[model samples]
Target: MQTEEGMVQDMKVLVVDDEKLVRRGLISMMPWDRYGMKVIAEAMNGTKALECMAAEPADIVFTDLMMPEMSGFELMEQLKLQYPRTAVVVLSCHEEFAFAQQAIRRGAIDYVVKNDLETDVMDEVLERIAASVRSRADNRPEQQEASLHPLFYEGESPVRLHGIPGTEAQLMPHGDSAQQASAEVCQALWQGMRWLYEDESFEQLLTLTAELRLPQSQLKDMVFPVLLKSGYLLLSLEHSLRWISRLEQSRRWEEWREVLQEERSYLRNLLFREKHAAEVVQGILQAVVYMHGKEELDFSQNEVADVANMSRTYFSQSFKGVTGKVFQDYVKELRLYKARQLLLQSSKPIYSIAQQVGFKDEKYFSKMFQQQYGMLPSAYRNQNPLRVE
Candidate 1:
């Protein structure tokens, strides 16, 4: 243990990876002092890691799942029987998430994806693991809960959360998590943005998104901000916001993956629609993002024209040229789409649902709803009740 000014900061870390660069990156990249941890040892493989542990015990072990001498899984099994006090954190590739899950079942405390470890992102992860380790050492489970999932308001009452700090979430982020996303992840996200102005193929974007994809809990910090940068504002897109909200509420990483798969499919359809190369389409994409944010479909063609900084006639022609849809019709269809969601999720009277979804008259809403969804709102709701979860 190390102490200065009568404070104890004594968590020791052991880093193990087969690749020398990976070992060096994990060791060099960590801000161990901030987390009250010190790197006591480094190893090229699991066998050497165990030797280091036997000589000088560590509080945490950051290990890669695959190695030349002994695999991470085998090392974990040995650690379980040998050093139960030490916690394991799997350092992994995106494709190795399945292995990480198995490691978790075998007693890994957490995981940090190697490919996604931007400096700040890694720091956030370190903070979480540190808090967890601190909590375990102190024998304070309450501190663990308070540190990780800090209190958020629910209605009027302040639900007790042991002794939560000012910050929220178990993950480290004093601010927006998105801003804290790693450079690689952010670059992967911008690959999609590049599609707006470049001739980037839909398949290319798909490959990027697939590689960038991580469990929402793992990715919570970065997706929104990068999406905003790419002009896919969730705030204005009510349905998309709902999708994210539901994803956040999901209980399992598997659920997050499922939701993400659907989101990617939606992006494929929207971003690649009648793909064009001219810069005017970039403006059209921006204008579409800006106006789509308003769920009521309240903005006028002139407003969008102004937003696009083009004459009404030209913007109209270009918007269709880019989207392959008339502006008014697009807005109408989007509003109807939102209405369909409200129908299944809420039991509001058909007229009320119509008004909330931007219909001046219930009859007109029903007409549009039928045209878009093939049924009246109430009938649709009857046919498809609110999903159980």
Candidate 2:
């Protein structure tokens, strides 16, 4: 369909409502073409909506706040995890406004009151959603290389030993035994990494690694190749292998033991650090989700750190390292961003808006808002008024 500028635009939409009449009315009465959107699919419940999405993905989902089988909030949580790019617009009645607000806090772009459904309201919502979609599209890079290896993102190389045949073939006396030992060491190493990723205790990883059985004579030969295959730098692997060989040639069993012990310690420490880094990333993600889902702005770094099961000092350092912003700065940005959206979309009084977005004092909220946007909240609202009267 053509926009006011006469440029053709097409956006796929999915409409979901449990009420048969409401579903039919939205599909039939709304001028989807005029807004450059097509009601490509419809579902009576969140379950059905998910099925429809699997069959044919849509640009936007307009879903009811409450439904059988799966509630709108649950579906939205799933969508945020799985299809983060798909924008959701909640449909609610007057009584469900609170639920709608919760949905917005949880990443929904907007909401519409069913009782106030009209051509103009739908038009405004559609335009806003379309503009957001376009902005995201424009900002995203055009080309992205698909990963071919499972461990690629984990800093592991996809390369395997070239000369060694299958593990079964290499299991014969000298060749087979060494290959078998290598395979076992590799498996143990990967298992240790997995344990670290799951935040399993470092003691557990150390114990598991210690239990792995490999011939001491074959340990260097077996472990070196696996380390190389596991994406370790060639120079480092070569240096390690050379050190082990020199120890063996000199018959310095005591020194060899010391070196091997150091290697094991290093591996354990590496896995622990990797696990800690992963946990930090996960903690930050959870914090952002919590910030968005809550109505009150009273949460603190201590609380979030507790949720992450990390010390406040360490959590703060990791938060800054990963997000490039301190905890307070990041939270302030989120609060101000949400406040700005509320100012533009709702006619709620300044005090109410401040409270809704988690500000206890309106004056403080206005001061922070002005600091962020360089203008008073009221002036900003006046400049970018809601499309709907």
Candidate 3:
């Protein structure tokens, strides 16, 4: 597809799978050029995939969920840390569908079930990825500038900065030369902190700080407060506050620098962990929604795990951790909840309603309903008869 400059940008793709036949089949079947893409490389597993990426970076990676040396999930995490711009799509078998969903939540753009792999599905996924890449490329400058704003102090209008465009001209901060210099240093340090949170390289942080003309002598003192205010430490900010005070009082600039670097590394790791946790929570919530909205109560933990792209064991544990119920119990509760709602709202007979909600035997359904609600389905329906208006 053509970029905004009207230049064609071929999407580079890397196909990864442990199975040789599957990899060969995908490479032969997919019309890469038709989708404005080219398979620049292929790998048998995640370890090989990383090696391939280092040699020839790809815009998109299609990887199998399970592979030797490194699993798809581990590769995804590594990619998120190293190549946040590249998009990932997972391929997995029907049994591992839940694991695929987890991959998507962890930053994979999409997933394809090997059992249901189709040309149309691949086409749709490719189209979506292309659109996303194009959109990001179009908005890159604006996004970069927006990300810079957090570095500014409160009420320090970012629009007025000469480096940033689109505002009425305003004079630079007017005051003592030293005071202005100090402010500039603080801003530089804040910008450095911003980069740290974004998982940027230390070299980029150094370049940005240098560009701001920050004095090296002031680096230690200037950076301390910015780290404290970053809010990344959350519950432990006070503890870090004490440590910062101690470092400053000790007047150990070299040690202070070391501590600051450590903190930045810590913050970067913390941000990634938090982001991963949020994704898992979101994936599980979506699974719960899917469970509640289904027409058939035939859903299994395996199916739910597939939807979340998590292993059944992991999904079960995570489901309990997030929702305070085991996977089976949660699904059973939802099915019964729906049964209750239908019992109270509709005139459908108990047997039909039971079957609709996935209960095969009416007697067993009645027993379950009675056990849950302390009354038979018919009795409950009679007591709360629907009002026809």
Candidate 4:
């Protein structure tokens, strides 16, 4: 385990096993300290492991398959379903290949046999697992460059001022200047991510902030938090738009609408470029917003192609590629989402609600509703009548 004085400070690991001898052997054999990992806790059984996890969560788990209770598989299942952020690496002396395979299925990041334990293999697994962890944390540089990044404040444009291509940004803050840079970077990342709903270049805004000169150690800290905050901000914005649109005060709503509008405008600017995938996503979102609540609208492939100003074949391909769904599916999902809102908030009948959300036939609407919500529209309405306004 790494000591506090020289540790990377980011890597935290947990070792769980029934056999104390084996646990101590594994811990003593590995150069865990060199790898920047610290053994935060040890547990003799699955139940104890869970307690340890709740008390001090570790980034990685090394567990033995056989234990007095709560075997490795059960612990892995609990962790996978609950604290999915923690990666599991299972171990066992038993020559049962099925046990390892099952571990993989349960979302264990990797499985290492006790018999196969070697310095080289352990190193390889650790490196691969660490890389995977980092990748899942944020979009790659290329992805960030392609997305639209919006600045929230009305004053100086941070991207324009700091993104001069040659400037080296600090990853984290150390002194007063570095700390200020970190704050600025975080703010820019938050605002840029909001704009990313419309445009894709939001990463440049963060990069511009990160470019402030700071120590290498501080810089690493800055990157992960910025990425994390960006994701949180995006999720919050999405939830607000979907569930609490009217709950916002008028002043707050006006501010929200203005930010959304600026984001949309920034995306439109990106779309003119015609070459970026962000532009393609921007175009699709524009189409989605335009069709919202238009009962008379029918989103044909040809119409979408025309709206996006591309061939039907190319448009369909790029639309699915960028959004991870076919155009038809995307439209259907959007309509269902809106319909759910209307059903919960308005006193409209099922047929009227269907028509309001672009479904012409009540029968088709009911069928689609059943497919999405697993209940008939009438039953759904009866169970969840509109809230009194």
CA-lDDT, candidates in order: 0.62, 0.59, 0.61, 0.57
Tens-digit lDDT track of model 3 for 1-389: 46568988898899998899999898888777777888999998888999999998888899886576887877888888877777787776532222432553575555566656587766755665566556545534335442222222223323322344564323323354744664675466464444554444454454344333332224434555454444321312333433343343322233444555676666556445434575676566567657766887887778989888899998887777655566777666666767766775567787888888878899998999788656787776664313111
Task: Tell me how far the alpha carbon of residue 42 in candidate 1 is from the true structure, in angstroms, after superposition.
Answer: 0.7
Q: Candidate 4: minimum summed lDDT over ten consecutive residues — where?
A: 241-250
How would you encode candidate 2's per-residue C-alpha lDDT over 1-389 as one tens digit per residue?
33468776687899988899999998888777876678889998888999999998887888886577777887788777777777787777532223433554576655566776677776765665666556444433232223121221232222224234542111124445554565565556543334323434444433332232223334444443333322221112323332333333322234344554565455435434434566675665566556666766678778888876789998788766655567877777767766766765678898998887778999999999887656798876664413113
| Model 4, span 1-389: residue lDDT tens | 23347544667888999889888988888777666677888899888999998999988889987676687878888987777767787776532323433554465655555766677777765665565445433323344323222222223233322435754332232446645755665655553343554334444443443234333223334432333332222211222221112111112223434544454454344434344566576566555445553554456778767777778888877766654567787678767656766765678887888887779999999999898767786665454312324
Candidate 2, residue 267: lDDT = 46
lDDT of candidate 1 over 7-97, digit per residue (tens)? 7767889999888988887788778888778899999888999999999989899988757668788888889899987888887653222
Instruction: State every prediction's TM-score relative to the real structure.
Output: 0.38, 0.35, 0.39, 0.35
Q: Is candidate 2 or candidate 4 better by lDDT?
A: 2
List pairs with backbone clashes in candidate 1.
148-169, 148-170, 177-221, 178-221, 178-222, 236-293
Error of 1 at 373 (Å): 40
Lowest-scoring 10 consecutive residues by lDDT in candidate 2?
229-238
Off by over 4 Å in 1: 1-7, 140-389
Q: What is the full ranking by TM-score, best candidate first?
A: 3, 1, 4, 2
Candidates' RMSD to native = 19.6, 20.1, 21.3, 16.0
- In model 2, where do residues sit more than 4 Å from their true spots? 1-9, 95-97, 140-389
Error in Å for residue 324 of model 3:
29
